[model samples]
Target: MLLNNRIKAFVELGKFLKQFKSTGYEKVNTVLYNDDFFDEMILKINTAEHHNGWFTKENVVFAIEQWADALSEKNLKEWLSSYQLDTIPCKTIGIVMAGNIPLVGFHDFLCVLISGCKVLVKQSSNDDQLLPFLTSYLVSIAPELNESITFTKENFKDFDAIIATGSNNTARYFEYYFGNVPNIIRKNRNSVAILTGTETREELEALGEDIFRYYGLGCRNVSKLMVPQQYNFDSFFEAIYPFNIIINGNKYANNYDYNKAVYLMSNYKLLENGFLMLKEDKSYSSPIATLFYETYTSKETLLTTLEKDEEKIQCIVGNNITPTNIDFGTTQKPKLTDYADGIDIIQFLSKIK
Candidate 1:
């Protein structure tokens, strides 16, 4: 009953927030540009988060509620019932955030919040400001959250359990050091796309949003492309080239220059656009200026390979219509309820709570 009530409340909140399209978005984006948020971000991005550009505040709200709705009836019930109900209490959940993508750690934040756990977020110093400001905004909506959620600068030590994300190297340490407790220690990963048949120009236009959103600095970004061998590259390039904005300015240019030198020196075939580069690498997630490639024979073979490598892939951002799991599988924008690690998040939080 309580869970149902909370869902209804969230829906109501969504309804109320829907009207905040223009002004609310403006405020959030404006605040992100302000130095206040960057104080936390500086630990990671130096001065770059501000320099790179902030996603419209509207993206944050849109993604969040998109997630809330994504975690809708059927999915929510599947996961929620996976564990027994009855408010589990006496919890303080700590989250080690990720900076690979904008507000990537928000899922863990939402999980802990929903599970009634005291959230002690050890934010990725890279994205310090976003989670803090986001938390503050949530508190504004649900004032009771002010008491529950506390964004901290203090290093978390004596927590019951933790949910952390880091590079494979850091994940090793987190798993060992945090081994004394139950936690979700995430290693590095990213999403990809499989362009089999036809993709429209508008779809490609929209697809560019996924590629350049954070200048390809996100885990959800399509760093790998799996196209059928017969598919000509020209159409794909044409569909995506208009949003060639990824190659401009400073930060992105640095990435282009650096990777271009390495490729030029090593004699690798690099398709360049000043900002984005396509190189032949097995790396699922490429550096800012580069992308990985593997030609596929058939969709069946591609599915088989992907299924085998499911553990490595994080999300799939393509133009496919069908819903997929073990895949962030969506051609359209990803709804919020979609999660990373494909783990039972609420259940994970519940145990700690």
Candidate 2:
């Protein structure tokens, strides 16, 4: 298939995804595929919770809507325009996906097929249903793409390159196993927010979304806060109180109960507001229903520390804190160009041959 055909198919997939949102799922005439696909998708969206307890309807729909907005012609063109697409040679690329958040590995899948290569995907068992269904819809829009896409449960073979996402331990295995292949091996990274004690109530509230969305499972979710010394938690706690209903889910509430008990037993001083817990810690990755915080003495000192630890960080959210920082609450809605780990995927794929 040609580049434009691939773009058209994804654009159509985006149109198909636009109908799903946190509010509800609605079928629209603009979707190019058959009614059967529309019906199947509706069923999948409804039953996503059964597949994975964390895959609630609201989170699944949020993921769908974000992708729907991203797959536009303008966005696709602008993201792909930086590379020389015609010079790329077709090859088979293997993808090992992560299921932390809905459609977490779709970008790699998109990059491989959009760059005129075949994709063999091995999905995380936690998130096996959604991507394959979407790929089927893409094939319906461009039947020629059928030969370029494959989903495998067996060992990965017959591929020229690979892109894999996993935790720090698994990444070491990936590095040793696929070390010889042209590959992008991703590991555990967490996002953080830097607060200078000058943020507005609105920005702090927006920061709540960054911390709570997807129940704080995604790499983009703000698991840690970098704050100035003497920062007050009164307003921070008030601003994020609106998200307290997150505790209604059994898995999240259970985690909160367990972690809170452990803290109390260890006599660790902590703060809580019924639903979420705030602990003073130095770690970037926090548990469910918990947010870790660290205090900094000076901006220069903090920046120097962060610069040295860039590999462990996925995104930094704040206002004017860093030149590369994402605005508060927008981390979950990453642009097509917001490559994870700051790696240019198209640039990676273009050189695969």
Candidate 3:
């Protein structure tokens, strides 16, 4: 039971996007630059600095496809059929975007859209193009939704609810502004890997993609590595040696050169890499240009510790021993079906009723 016009509108958006293939680096910035009036200072960031900042043609097209796939009538019906979203009094929902990674703000948009509410999105300064371009196309495809969407940087007010994603520091600010309001506050987090078994060369190479994609600036990227105490670094290095080309690339190579010199000069305990940082520590997240990895003698103890700290862990990216749906390496892109922090957002909203 859906309106024919709405369905056609969504499908047409998909049709428009299917024609695009994500471009590399500067081309992506050019397209995004053309999309909106972001402040020039933010737009002029070094390419090596904001690796995933560029949303190439393929990325944009995939984003549209992802939106279409998420919004299809059949999928909505199936999702709704699983639970009673009707119990909640849904209305306008505001979302504050996170620009640290590509489309990190999209899940909140999906939440508002799926819950049958008008969406008011405030684009992050670091990300001004994607949403505006996207919504514009959607409006063209289906004029009916023109009323359902709004984008702005206005001081947010007059919203029934909101979702905000920011760094651990900014989350306090978000809480001050929107804490009383019903919302999902997403703070910065990074995924981890639990190594229980040995990995093949193919698997290690795949791990390289997980580490380097978006230049390791994403929450989904494996920012930390866990290996057994006896697991020597030889086989691992051999597997990733082929990716020397990737490590030696412009941005990555610079990160390597800088970090390597800093570690040696400061006498910090860390391994050398032209790109990746192999530090021995028990943490999940890393700085934009850093990696934190540690080894453990006891697998069982590590799993228990991880379970105890599940709040800090977002997703696991690895081979063999990861939990179901945690993701293998090759599928770097997440489908719209994937929920953030594994929370059932619809249920989260309904609980307040």
Which is the leading candidate under lDDT? Answer: 2
Per-residue lDDT of 54-142 in model 3, one digit per residue for the tens?
Answer: 44333344444455455555665555676565566657788888886555687677566655567899988766656665667656555
Q: Model 1: per-residue lDDT, tens digit, 181-215?
A: 88888888777777765877666666666666656
Clash pairs, candidate 2, are: none
Better of 2 and 3 by TM-score: 2
lDDT of the candidates, in the order given: 0.63, 0.91, 0.64
| Order by TM-score, highest first | 2, 3, 1
Task: Report, for all candidates in order, the number of backbone clashes.
Answer: 7, 0, 5
Query: Which stretches of candidate 3 lie above 4 Å from their native place?
Result: 1-8, 22-81, 85-88, 247-250, 319-325, 351-353
Model 2 — TM-score against the truth?
A: 0.98
What root-mean-square deviation over C-alphas does model 3 reach?
5.6
Candidate 1 residue 333 C-alpha distance from true site, Å: 3.9
Residue 167 in model 2: shift from native, Å?
0.5
